[model samples]
Target: MATLDLSAHLKEAKKHGPQARGISDMARSLVGSEILRIAGEVKAFAAQGNKVLDLTVGDFSSKEFPIPQPLEEGIIRALKAGHSNYPPASGVIECREAVRQMFERRLGLGYPVGSVLIAGGARPMIAGIYYALCSPGDKVVYSLPSWNNNHYCTLVGAEKIEVPTRPESQFFPRAEDLAPHLGQARLLCLNSPQNPTGTVIDRDALSQVCELVLAENKRRQQAGSPPLYLMYDQVYWMLTFGGVTHHTPVSLYPEMAAYTIFVDGISKAFASTGLRVGWAVGPTDVIERMSAILTHLGAWAPRPEQIATAELLNNGPAVDSYLAQMNRNLFTRLGKLSGAIEALKGKGWNVDCISPQGAIYLSLKIDLRGKKTAEGKLLRSDEDTRKYLLEEAGIALVPFLCFGLAEDTGWFRASVGAVSLADCDSFQARLTGALEKLS
Candidate 1:
């Protein structure tokens, strides 16, 4: 047998490097994740034996917060029972019913089992909504500083209408901000206990949004146009703190259920991001459409994991117990970080933070623009500010610009999901020293 060596051909191709050739327009136009890029730098720094408190990625460090005991055992038992086969393309019946019971029991939204569609995680469901509803060039309206909506829009060739939000409203689009665009939009996206910000929308604010969506869909129906759909991403719903409550559109107006698709999963709520179980609850017809689209992607959750998730969801006592403790642990760290930042602000450090509200994040503002570093380098943009913090303080963070803020506002997301109380304590000391090094 003889083998031909293609080393020369491979070298020539490698030497020329990639020119954007022959790829789909979407692939060519797609932007990479700045969060991951920053995280990569953090990893490299830590790899050099440098001590860095990595608060960049929106993920839990298993050591800091492991998945729940029951969930873990359930998976083990399932595998022992030989549940290794592919789950139904939609999901196992047991898991779907559990989700249905969960909605009615926890959220008070009564729906048939057909309304729930299971997937690998909330991402596929989100992508499914975009794929199932919007044609090319159809408009998708979402707030700025949101997670991955821009990339999804690009994936489906949908027109993007990003509405700018203010810090006062906690980075959530108000009814008035979204009203003008909804008439033309095919889908509207909302996430509460929002990623990168950790702010929960007030019930009144969410109610107003539901009303707006209702009115818009009503108008579309009258005109014989396709109904506008709402994709509510509530993956962090179970992790709220500080007396804040998580609200939903369907829960507010029962009629709104006809147009809402709720995205939820065990990732954030159970510290089980790697287990890959997620689902959506929506109108049965809409759920069917999403299923038809997502089925081709093989996006259904694993059979064993689905069965295990169903067990966990039905275990009300276990869920409540876990969440109560989880919330306490999360709030402890988030509060500590926020308090430390506030103390720095009180001392006039040009740093400020929103008090911890919900989710594993704290919205921090560290304005170092025009300030001379010890090396006389002027920090001019958010990236510059981020770099200064990461390099000098060894505290990694994801700047709001990465989340599509469009402005160099010096704001950043510091996630507590992967850090401990001690880690959070370390943040204050390092942040203070770094800020002091700046003029």
Candidate 2:
């Protein structure tokens, strides 16, 4: 029998740190699209006429809600004009300039052109910031029941500290909870008009958080620690449904602009998910580093897409008409869904939900342990109810389990964004029927 020298091979493997070991470790720790997978299966079942009334993913259904007409035409023209080559790595100058202008005009914040980088979506923008700012074993703080990608802290070799929020406080992390962690935190992730739960962080809450972040960063610097970084995932920036005033972290704290990275794009507001485009704004150094990283990953976003996007922004009237219609369409659906959830509480389900001020989702609570129908049947976990709803009542919902939640809970997320206002009524009916049947 021949014995191989394993130690020599292991030493050779360790030499490829940044390229192989680091990134591979990052990949392994990151969570994949668990919700999307369930959503896909339900969609397949629906297509097969299984009577699946899916509420699993956040997608806007094609109904009276129309895609922006001008952007579509602009894209066609750009493609026909032969603008198919690789664009500048940072992003096209025109798009970057538009982004800077939008920030100033809309949010009242100013960012220089060199401070922006365009990516496929907010996810890539997040990944770029993590790569640029976090080191192995650094701590990153965020709130729970958040977008599961907060798990990416581990991917960047950073520790994830979750500030568990309460229902009474609207599930937002308070500054007091964050202050203790600031000394060790390398990054903080804030998602406004949050995914799953459509709770928009109130302006006052943001103001308090900004003050805490700055004060704590100053303390940490005095103690000779690295400054804490802030990644604001404002993907639903322009998707406010009700009369809520949207707040930007960068706008709230310009001093923290050096540490703050803002993620935004056209996916939610413009319904352009298939376009695979988004942009980030941060410090010049941070943008430069992330752009280099993106270049190594992919040369650049398609040139035609950038040109088309610029045209859409530069043309005011067409975009305004689209935005107006979209706001009306979204609010109509969200109002219907909120009313449905509120009505369920009277049925002994004891469900509680917050009306979404922005974005498409409304996170609802079902007291699994206490839930009972007038008929006296017990309600179990969200997954069990979801299955019963799908198989028996023809309704589909993404269970809380898919969002990295603990067991024995009665929370689930439904998207009111994709479905039309009329379909949302049907969805509510289907859901009501399922709840009634369970009892």
Candidate 3:
């Protein structure tokens, strides 16, 4: 072969305007998050000096809801004590031990410290699990209107089987819905109290799911195929409201320990998303492989944060107090918005809202489709309804399409993470005006 003329090729390529940048086929096939795109529009609108109640982002506003005081103090102390070095590829020993204890104490699930892998956040842990277990074109099952499962499936080159959850079940997948797909799936991704929908799987439903998974794993083993694994994303487990209890597969059925990998962290429970700490707990072999994958990717959680998190998880009183207060604050905002939407529905507005269930999200339905605006714009799709609400009500919310739902699913997720009680209180009048103007 002739020697490559690298410099000549570079010079010629530069002459043809800006050279086209190349991305992997996988990267090129992925679509960006519509939630973030809507958030960008909200930012631009706010930049014009208009007051907008932005509920698009699933993030805590430090002013409205701060991270646990103990966690914050512990982080400060860790930094002061010179915990700036790199952490173990898996995690600091103390942090892993703390995670072990936390799961055992809180959820009655016992995984050895060796089975826990820490990473920058739940995203990395999730990606690592996908990378570790899934082969190209392997089937991965999840529910639609979920958070990031589709994107993860795309990233791993797995065939996605998105089960459409029904509203009657609070938009959570039933065992029957998922049973049909389990035989062919290598990974089943689940989240509860789910992002976007704020729903939790009922105990009975979850028990059945665990049974199905166990059965599938047995069949796979008999057939000499790789076992199906469940990636349980329970980041919002602690945020369940009212009498709703969060359930995990391993907790209900101990046998699930062999096939379930938990993706959890302080991102939601403690409102520490920016702290960049999360973990995965699973079978030792799977976790070891995931740890190796994450190690090569260099996605370890920060040393100081990990050290601080260890202290915080072990602080029972502080964790309990913070969770109670956080739940109260979140519920107040969700309740207010849900009630306001119900009131509007009573007044003949084509709007409805599910009662706040678990997470800091309220499921809102604004069926403004086929309605004509004052400016003669027809509200056709969920996007149209989203824009109408944003422009006319000065209220920003994320449509279900952002969460991988169909364009016509008139549903939206109003995240209360960044909004305050006062912000929710103001939503009614603005929303009423917007609805009135629509007709």
Candidate 4:
């Protein structure tokens, strides 16, 4: 066999047979969120730069009003007191009670302890709801230009229907707009004081949505169809600006409360996003299902953190102070951003600007076409101009294409929550400089 060298025949063999696919097709179908993708790249770019004002993350960055000092001391106390063990998956009884009471008083709704399921944050709470309530081949409806996480419905194997939400309708989808899908939708996920757009749904509009969803659900049931579920994301419920009170889904059509799962977290309200504490409250059956689902995921939130959160929430002063400070800080910065945007529009750029009633972001549509920069480059889409601004102007913004809007060319989301009033003035100047260069 002339030495029969095995190495000589190594390249002659073909590859192995294909393996079975364990992951769901839905998971594979999802693309990474556009905002996250761009934000990641911009962050990497900024890391190497000498100066970069990172406005990409929407987290608050004010030192004027710190998180309650006593609460921080309490967290340290809990840790030092050796309360750092694993907790009940449903959450500690004390914190759960505090959550229940907070909802009861804040939203004027009564919820027993069994109705709440604590998780890492609003994202998990939302995912748990989808897992517990929605099966594959279900349909989930929402409005367009909504939060990117709204696609979690699709990731959970539900068909996502995005109703058009425009400036004319105050950025809320009309009940009539939902008529076609109401009969078939298994879940409707929504957020108000909505992210990116910051449009609050009025009491009348919210009431109409509740009535329509419930009425359609009843019609489906009478026709032997399964009841639809409503999932409300209320993470920003407390961060309203300009005299807008947060509205809970439970406030409207309490009867449909049986079918709605409300997701709330301490991230936005308390600026404790790093704590990873959030809860979902709803009907007993839903909670029971979520509890079982959470068990498979194991140990609840950190015990000491939960205790600290409960103690802070139990006190009215800390929460009130936090809310007031947040409102004041955001109001001032939003005024600055709005003014800058208006001035840009006055400078002959066609821009679509939404006056934010609440939330931390200002959605902007900057005209990038027919613009030449100092570098002699012609402007194009939002991503193109976003990169130009970040690299040339040291500013970072999330382009709006991540929210599934096709006509969102040249659109971006700028967060004013972290920028101080002084910093905002500087930012406005930098923005105008960039605009002039492009023009």
Best by TM-score: 1
Q: Please, what are the lDDT tens digits per residue for candidate 1 over residues 298-393?
A: 888988899999999999999999999999999999988888898999898888888888989999999999999999999999889888988899
Off by over 4 Å in 4: 1-27, 62-66
By TM-score, the better pick of 2 and 4 is 4
Q: Model 2: how far is 218 from its true place, Å?
A: 1.3
Candidate 2 lDDT (Cα, whole model)? 0.76
Tens-digit lDDT string for candidate 4 (1-439): 5877786455444232222334556665667777777768877886796366566666766463356665688789999999977888798888899999999878888988999888777777877888887787777788877786556766677777888776777667888888788787888877877887766778888888888878887787789877888888888888777766667657877887877899888877777767778898999898888878877876367888888888988999878986887778877877777788888788776766777677777777776766778878887667678888888778888876667776646767788766667777776678777777765
Give me the displacement of residue 16 in model 1, in angstroms: 6.2
lDDT of each: 0.91, 0.76, 0.90, 0.77
Candidate 1: regions farther than 4 A off: 1-21
lDDT of 3 at 75: 87
Any runs in candidate 3 off by more than 4 Å, and if so which?
1-20
The lowest-lDDT stretch of 10 consecutive residues in candidate 3 is 14-23
Better of 1 and 4 by TM-score: 1
Error of 2 at 399 (Å): 3.2
Q: How many backbone clashes does candidate 2 have?
A: 3
For model 3 the local lDDT of residue 124 reads 96
C-alpha lDDT of candidate 4 relative to the true structure: 0.77
Over 1-439, each residue of candidate 2 has an lDDT whose tens digit, in order, gives 9988799888898887746665665566566687877877677778877866566767665555455777778778989998888888899898888788878877888788998888776778888988889888888888777786566776677787878776566667888878888877888888888887777899888988999888887887798877888889888878886788788776777797978998888788888776767899998998999999888888365777777777787777776778877878777876776788788776656677777777777777654454554456565667656656676567667765676555545667777656655677775677776666554
